[model samples]
Target chain A: MIDIALTEEQRDCLQELINVAMGQASDKLARFLNTFVHLNVPNIELVNFDSLPADFTENYAQQNLSVVSQGFYGNEGIRGESLLIYKVNTLDDVAKILGYEPGEISDNEQLTDISSILTTTFLNGLAELIENQLSYSAPRVVSSATSSLDDHLKQLSFDWDLALKVDISYMVTDYSFDCDMVLLIPGEAVKNIQLVLERILKEY
Target chain B: MDLPQINQFLVKEINVGIIVIDAEAKVKFINQFVLSNTDLATDYQEQSLFNLFPELPEKWLKRKIESVFTLNTPAFTSWEQREYLFKMRHTRPITTENDYMAQNCTLLPMSNNADNQPELLGFIIEDATDVCFYQKQLSQTVEKLEISNRTDSLTKVANRRYWEERLAIEFERAKRHNQPLSLIMFDLDKFKNINDTFGHVAGDTVLIEVAQNVAQNLRQSDLLGRYGGEEFAIILPETDAEGALVLAERIRLGLAMHQIKVDEGTVIATLSLGVICICDDYSQYEEMITRADMALYQSKRDGRNRTTLYQA
Candidate 1:
C-alpha cells in the first residue's frame, strides 16, 4: 500500500459519514424485509490487492461467498467499487422470512436477485451521502470458488494503487444470517473524498 | 372483434410448465402445462412455494424471488447444478436409466396489475433430460479411451511409454525430498533356448506366467511394466538397493517354483534379475537404469537364475 497516512480525526469523520449513510440504507432494507438490521462499527484498513482475502477475512476461511459488485463513478472525480458479500448460509433464514416454507423450488435465482438489490441500494445510498451524483452500474454476481479467493480478486481488472478498505457487518433481526460488505476506494480517489469531507465539516 | 394470438396464449399452452408465485412465496397460479406434466396439486393458490413443492430448496427459492422483487429483472438456473427443481421422474432412452427429469428454469419478476395488486414472480420450466444424459455418456467414453492409451496389450501391465513418463516424475520427486529410489530390470533366463526346443508357443506361455508371478510378489507401491519383448522393469519409489534386491529375489524364486503347461508337457522357467539404487553421483534417471542394466548382464554371465546388485 502507498503509505499515505490518515489523521485520527479524519478517520473518525470518515467513519461517521459511512455510518450515517449505511444506517439509512439499513432502514430502507429493514422496511422492505419488515425486519431490523444490526450494524457493526465500520472499520478502515490500508491493504494491497494481492493480500485482500487474507487481510479482509482475518477470522474466517474461504467459505462459499456470493459477491454482488457495483462500480460507481462520481461527478466529483471519485470512483470506487462496493461489494456485498453473502456467506450463503444466511439464505435459509431469509427464505423463511420471505414466506417460503421448509421444502420448495430452489431459491438460487432468488439469492442472486436479492444480492443485486441489496448491494445496489446500499452502495447508491453511500454515494448520495457523499454529495456526489455517483452513477452506479448494474450489479454483477460473482459466485467465485472459495478456495482461490485471492486469484479471483486479482482478476478484477482494476489497476488500483491502494485500497482503502471499509468493512461493514450486518445481520437480520431474528435471523441467523450475518454478512459482510466492503468498500474499496482507490488511492487517487482519497484526495477527492477528503475534500468532500472538508466541505461537509465546514458546513456542519 | 377477434384478436390475433399473442405470445402469452401460446406460452401457457406450450409443453413447458409455467408457474407464478408472489413476493410472499405463495403460489399464485399454475398453467395447464405445469399441472399436466408434474404432480402439482390444484389447491396451489395462496400456498407457500415451499409447502406446495415440499422438495425444493426453501431458502434458495426465497433468495431468488426476493432478488427478483428487488431488482425487477430475470434470473436463471439449469439442470447442471441440482438437475431438476421438481421431483418429476422419466426414463432415459440411451442408458435405460430411470431418474429425475432434468430441467432449465427461468425466474422473472412480474409487474403488478393496473388494479394495484401485488407483483408476482414467474417461473418457466423446460425439460432438458436428454441433453444431460448424452453429456454423461460422452464423458464415460472419454475415460475408457484414456485407460486404453496407458495399458499394454501383451502383458496387461503398464506399457513402456507410461512407465518412462512415471519414472521421470518419481526421479525428480525423490531427488528433491532426499528419498531413496531403486530400479530393477530382469529378463527370462534361457528364453531363446526354450523357444527353439519347445516351440514359440511354449515360450509365450512361460513369459505370461512369469510376468504374473513377479507382479504377485511386488509391493503395491512398485510399478511393474513390460520394458521390451522379454525384458521387464520395475520402478521402486522410496526403496533402497537392499529392498529392491529382496523383492527381486522373491520374484526369481517364484518363477523357479512355477510350472507352465504347453501342448507337449510341462515346462519350467527361471528368471535373472538386477537391482540398483539412485546415488548422488548420478546426473539423471537414465543413469540409474544403466547401472541396473550392467548388473543384469553380470547376473546372466554369472549363471541364469540369480539376482545381482550393483554396489556403486
Candidate 2:
C-alpha cells in the first residue's frame, strides 16, 4: 500500500482553505433558505478505504440517516466526492423550511435541493482558491432511512486505498436541522491537494 | 463537413433535448429534439424560455440556473427529486401512470469560443419515464416482499421472527418509561386432533379464523404473532393485569363462539391463554414469555377454553 499523509503545514493550509469555502457555502444556504446557518470547524483526516465502513458505522449507527453523494472532477487531476448526511428525523423541519409538505418524495426533494446548493457552492469556492476549474456529476441519493450507513459504505466501489476526508457540520439556527458534509479526496487527488497547499504556504 | 457543422449535426440529432441560454434566460440556440418532442415552436429562437413555457417553476429554475452561472459548474435534477423540469407529455408506446413525462435535467456551464470563461449555460433534458416506471414497480415488489417476510402466510399475522423483534423493542421501551406492558401466549386446545381427524387443511382454517377473531378484539397497538405450529403470542403495551385478562378473555370467548368453516365441515375451536403483566422482577421479554407459557399450561391443566393470568 502506498502511504500518503499531509504534512503539518499542508494540513493547516488545507484546513484554512476549507474553512473559507465552507463559510461561502453557509452564506449561500442562509440566503437561499432565508434562515441563519451555523457552521462547525471542518475536521480533516487521512483514512484507509478498508476501514471506512467500520468508521462510518461507529460514528453514525443506530440512528436513521439519509446520505447523498456527488462526484466532482477538475483540472490538474483534482477530483473527489462530496457526501451530505442528514438525520431522518430532522427532515420534517427541513421540508417545512423549503416549503414542501411532509412526505417521502418531498423529503427526498428537500435533501436533493440542499445538497445541490451545498456541494456546488462549496466545491466551486475551493476550486477557485486553488485556481482549478471543476465540473460535477449529478447528485444521487446513495441511501435513505431504510438502509444503514455500514451497508451503504460497504457496497461502495472504492478504487483508491487512502483518502483525505474532511467533515463539516451545518446547523440551521432556531431549527432542529443539522447535516454533515463529508468530502473525500482519494489517492492522487490527496497528493495534488497537498502540492497546492504547499504552493499556497510558500506564497504566504 | 467542418468541425462546427459536425458538432451542430450531432447536437441536433441527439435523442436528448439541448437548449443553450444566456444569463438572461433568452434562448440562444435550441436543438431539433426539443422542438420535436414538445409543443414549443421553432420560432422560439430569441424568446425567453419562461415565456414559451408559462407553467415553468420560474423561481426554482432561475435559482438552479443562476447557481451554475455563479459557480461555473454543472447542476442536475432527477425525476426522483423534482419529477420533471419541463412539463411535456411522453411518447412511449407503453401506457404510463404519470400525467407528464418524467425528466432528468442537467445544466452545464458553456464557455465562449473567444475566451475560456463561461458565458452561457446548456440544458440537457432526458426522458426518464421508463426509468420511473421500472423503479416504481421494483419498489412495490420490494415492499411486498418485506411485508411477506415479516408476516405469517398461514394466519396472516406477524411471523415468529418479526414478533420476537418487536417484543424486544416494546419490552425495552416499557422498562425505560416504567409503563405497564403485557404478554399473552395461547394455542388451540387439542389442535392436533383436528389435523389428525380432518387434515392439516382443516387445522389451517381453524388457525386462520382464530387469528382473525383475536385480531378484531385487540387494540391497534397490540401485536399478534404466530409463534409456531398451533401457538401464537401477543404483546400489549400500556396494559395492566386487569386489562390483559379482559383482552385474553375476549379473545378466548370470541373464538369459542365462532364456528370455523373448513373443506370438510364446520368445526368449533377453543383457546387456552396465559397472560402476564410487566413487573419489577422481570428483566427480559423472554422471561415474561416463559411465565406466560407456564400460565397457559396451567389453563390447560384446569380444563380448556379459559384465560389464566400469571401470579407474581
Candidate 3:
C-alpha cells in the first residue's frame, strides 16, 4: 500500500482529536434528545475492505427507531466516509432528560416529533467539523436503505494502493439509558488524519 | 413533434391492426401503420410469427410453417376465417413507461420471395380501437421481404448472415467516426442438454422466449440477431468495453430473473456473455468477434451466467 502507517503517538493524538470531535457530536445529539448524552470512543482500526465487520443491519439496530446518515470527506487532500447512527429508544431517555414526564404515551408524539430535527442537527454539526478540517464539499446524506458502506467503497475511484481506513465506535451510557454510533472511515482519509495529528503533536 | 398533432394522427389517421395469416395460418408480415397501432406488450421487432404470438394456436401454426417451408406455396387466411368475432383491445406494452393506442388486429396473406411465389404468410394488424376509424393502410411486404433475408427463421431476428453483413458496415462507421462500438457475443448456458432432455420443441420455445426478452431490454438503435444455434449477438453502436460489460451483466441478470413457464416445471435459464469494444482503427469485424468469443469462453470457465470483457 502507498499509505504510511501511524506511529503509536500519532494514533493516540488522532484518537484524542476524534474524542473531541465526537464530543461535539454528542452534545448536539443530547440537546436534540433532551437528555444527558454520553459518547465514548472505545476503539479505532486501520484496515482494508476485506476486514470490515459483518452484521450490517445489526450494527444499526436498536429497540427504538434508528437513523443512519452517510457523507463523504477529504476528496482531494484527505478522503473517507463518515457515518452517524441514532437509536430512537435512546431518544426516549433523552426526552426524559429534557424535562418531559417519563413513559407517557399520549405525550409521545412530542418525543417522536424530534426525529427529523435531531438527525439534522447532529449530522450537520458533525459534517461541518469534518468539512472545516478537510476543506471539501458539503456532506451529501446517503439513504440508509439502498446505501451500503461496502457498495460505497466499490463505487470509489481512488487509487486503492493509497487507501487507509479509520474505523471508530461511539457509545452512550446513562446508567439505565444507552445508545451507540459506528463511524466508518474510508481507507485514504485515515492516512491523512494520521499525518495531520503527527504535525499537530510536534508543534505542541 | 407536438403531442397534440401526434395524438390526432394516431387517433384519426391510422387503421393499423389489419393482419392476414396465410392458408397455413402463419404471420407473413405486419404493415407499418398497423405495427404502430398495435402494441404487443412485448418487443417483437423482426420476430417471426410463432415467436411473437406464441400462443397463437402453435400446433396449427407449426403445420403451416412446415408447409410454407416445404411446399413453397402462399397460404391465405381470409378475414372471414376467424373462429369468433372479438372486441379489439388497446394495449401499450410498456405501461410503466408510456401510454399508447390499443391495436386492432386483422390477418391476411402477403407473398414476397425469390421465386415470384408468395413465400411469406403475413399478419396485417390495424390500430383502430382508440381512433374509432381507419386512417391509412401501410404494406411493408417488399421491405419486410428484403429484411426477412437477413433474419433468423426461428426467432425472426437478424440471422448470422445479417450479422455478418451489418457488423462490417458498423465497424467501418465506428472507425471513420472514431466512436465507441461494442459487441456482446453470448450463448445460452446448458442449451444442448435442454434440447436433449426436453424435446426440440421445448428447446425452440426457450430460444424464442430468451430472444424476445433480450430484444425487450435492448435500445431501439442496438442491433440484436441470432448469431447461430443457441448463440446471440448484440451490437451497441456507441458503447465502449466498460459500457458493454455493464449491458452484458444486465442481460444476464434479466434472463436469470425471468422464469419461462414451459409445462409442469419452470425453466431457469442462464447466459454467458463476452463483450468487446471495437478500437478506433478496427479493420476486421472478425477480430472483435474473436475477442468477444474469448471473453465468452472466459465467462463460462469462470462459472457461467456472468459477463467477461475482452482485455485488449
Task: Report the lDDT tens digits of candidate 2 across residue range A82-195.
Answer: 888887887767665654445634567667876877788788878888887677877889898766666666665556656556777777776767677777667787777777
Q: Could you arrange the candidates by DockQ from highest to lowest?
A: 2, 1, 3
DockQ of each: 0.08, 0.40, 0.00
Which ten residues in a row are the worst by lDDT in model 3 chain B? B77-86
DockQ top scorer: 2
Per-prediction TM-score? 0.60, 0.87, 0.34
- Model 1 Cα shift for residue A114 (angstroms): 12
Per-residue lDDT of A1-204 in model 1, one digit per residue for the tens?
454456676677777877787787677667666777776777766666656777756644646766666666777778877666677666676565545555454455445445555665565566667655444544555544433445546666566655666676667777766566666777677677777777877778
lDDT digits (tens) for residues B1-312 of candidate 1: 234456668766787878888888888888877777668778889988788788887666666666556544455666755678876655454563637778877776676531132388888887788878877888899888877887777677778998888889889999999999999999888889889989988888877877788899778888998888889899999999888888889888887888888887888888788899988998789998888889998999998899899987
Each model's iRMS:
5.6, 3.7, 36.1
Report how far off residue B296 is in candidate 2 (Å): 0.2
Model 1 alpha-carbon drift over 4 Å, by segment = A1-204, B1-4, B71-74, B91-95, B112-118, B197-202
Q: Specify the highest-TM-score model's number.
A: 2
Cα-lDDT of candidate 2: 0.83
Error of 3 at A85 (Å): 80
